[model samples]
Target: MSNELYHKCHEAISQGRAILEDLQQWDFETIIQYPQAEPQSTASHLSTTAMPSTEKTTLAEMESGLKGCSLCSLAKQRKNIVFGAGNPRARVVLVGEAPGREEDEQGIPFIGEAGKLLDKILLAMKLSREEVYICNVLKCHPPGNRDPQPDEISACEPFLKQQLALIKPELIITLGRFAAQELLKTTQPIGKLRGQWHEYEGIPLMPTFHPAYLLRNPSGKRPVWEDMKKVMQRLG
Candidate 1:
């Protein structure tokens, strides 16, 4: 067989293997809940004040306002703009970079394989999706799941800020490098950012590896669990 065909065959086999792996039920027992500790004070001057006022006071209003949004080219090909889901009045808000294939299809955040893993992680922390608000930095999916462009983020960030302003969550958890960097406005690697407590708009923010990363690197589960344990302890 030619080299090109050989590579294609290998790629197909790898994709099939990944599909099979995704289909198998993941073990949740490994996601044990570590004991929570008392929330500690941070010297970092980040405040707990609410975000600046916006026209949209309620999530409903925000969603309605975003209808037919065409601020960026992403809206042109997107099936739906993922407005987000979960408790509108949640104390904790989970933020991701952007929508993926399944998220774009369903117009929901974190509903794919990575989402399933996130559900398990939340369960391990004795939390449910209903207890937290989930959203993304960009409402629309980038073509081929590429990194969000600067213009796209600029167009979409205001809506996200408005969402946070309305929700006024006590704490925020950012998933993955892009989510963390974009919100924090820093270029620090996730390894350096994770396992540390940061602040965003006066709310305590924690950065951790995305569940999709955990799927690819099973060893990352331990550190992500450590991060969640810190979150639980902070909420206590």
Candidate 2:
């Protein structure tokens, strides 16, 4: 082994010994060590070498991976993979439920009239779609715009988690009850979830009415505006 590899082995042993000492009640002798055999070429060894880095897979790579994914039944009926699009390094990420007719057709989230409303709302805050990331809980659209089944959400959750990990947003704004409930893992209604700051995997989450819902209930815009104010304050 190289000097670096020797040092790494020593550090690992020291850490293991510390853990064993701390957990005195447990048997540490049962620990297993699996060694990887060396490859033939220097290129192969370089490929296998581990590096300390935080960069994640690109959004395009993620979408490509999901293109053929059949993790849930939604894959069968989906006309397109609404894999989400926007700035990958966005500070804010807007999460919604599943796709609708336009979204399914275009393979993008938050399109059509609802999307238009979202655009206006963002403009009012002096932000544009290019400035933030947008995605849905389900990458594929549920037929007839129905609520995503629990199993479907579970199947597609890892993609969302990966997107979050890659974006590493300072704030996440969930639209509608389903988005809030699914991301926050709470059964609370939108009314209860809104107007207060919450945390999802350590990132600040703000739940508010969906743009489609806002189109239906224009009166509720007041509270949504309140929630938006909080988001802007934090982002500022």
Candidate 3:
């Protein structure tokens, strides 16, 4: 595929993830008011800026707000957006870094080999995909499967905040260094980040190695399992 076409595919993937991020917001209502003559120009508030204040919010409406967003350049190269799947009101939520090549292609989080392993891990937790909501810090795949850029994360923050605000999950499990670090707003390494409980928006967060990491270092699986067991114990 030509470079232009390839990048366009990634842009679409981003759009897909943004839609998924907003899907569950349909369950809750936010106050909506008419906008003024001119809205402020802010990348972080891209979605809300275009729309009036919402008393009742829907994922569809949220998605509409994000339409035509160019808060960051990532939008230009995206093919589709990947959204979270499963229960909207789930008690647990899992956050990852960004879409991989496979995730971007499918516009679904965790559908690749790593996702398959995540499935098994969920099974070990005595949970199914239906019981939780899954998403990434970035809705779109980073070009070349690289780590998410700071500007991209900044642009996408509102979508994530809205999801957390709406779902109000009892526990949040962060996968990988970026997800954990970004959520924690710390530069600490994943080694220091994992194996403990952190807080985000008043919800309990547990950091663990990404399935991709476990694939690279099989020894990491045991710790991830231990972390899940802690999460299971906490749920009880």
Which of the numbered candidates is closest to the native, going by highest lDDT? 1
TM-score of each: 0.77, 0.76, 0.75
Model 2, range 90-208, lDDT digits (tens) per residue? 99999999889899999888998999999988998889999999999988888878899877786778889988998899999999999999989999889999988999999999999
- Candidate 1 vs 2: which has more TM-score: 1
Residue 36, candidate 2: how far off, in angstroms? 32
TM-score of 1: 0.77
Tens digit of lDDT per residue, candidate 3, span 1-236? 99999999999999997876785464322444655656555544444433322232655455555544556766667776775676778999999998888887877899998999999999989999999989988888889889887778877877888877777899999999999999999999999889999999889999999999998899999999999999999999
Error of 1 at 129 (Å): 0.7
Off by over 4 Å in 1: 1-54
Question: Model 3 residue 55 lDDT?
Answer: 30
Query: lDDT of each model, Cα atoms only?
Result: 0.86, 0.83, 0.82
Clashes of each: 1, 0, 34
Worst 10 residues of 3 by lDDT: 47-56
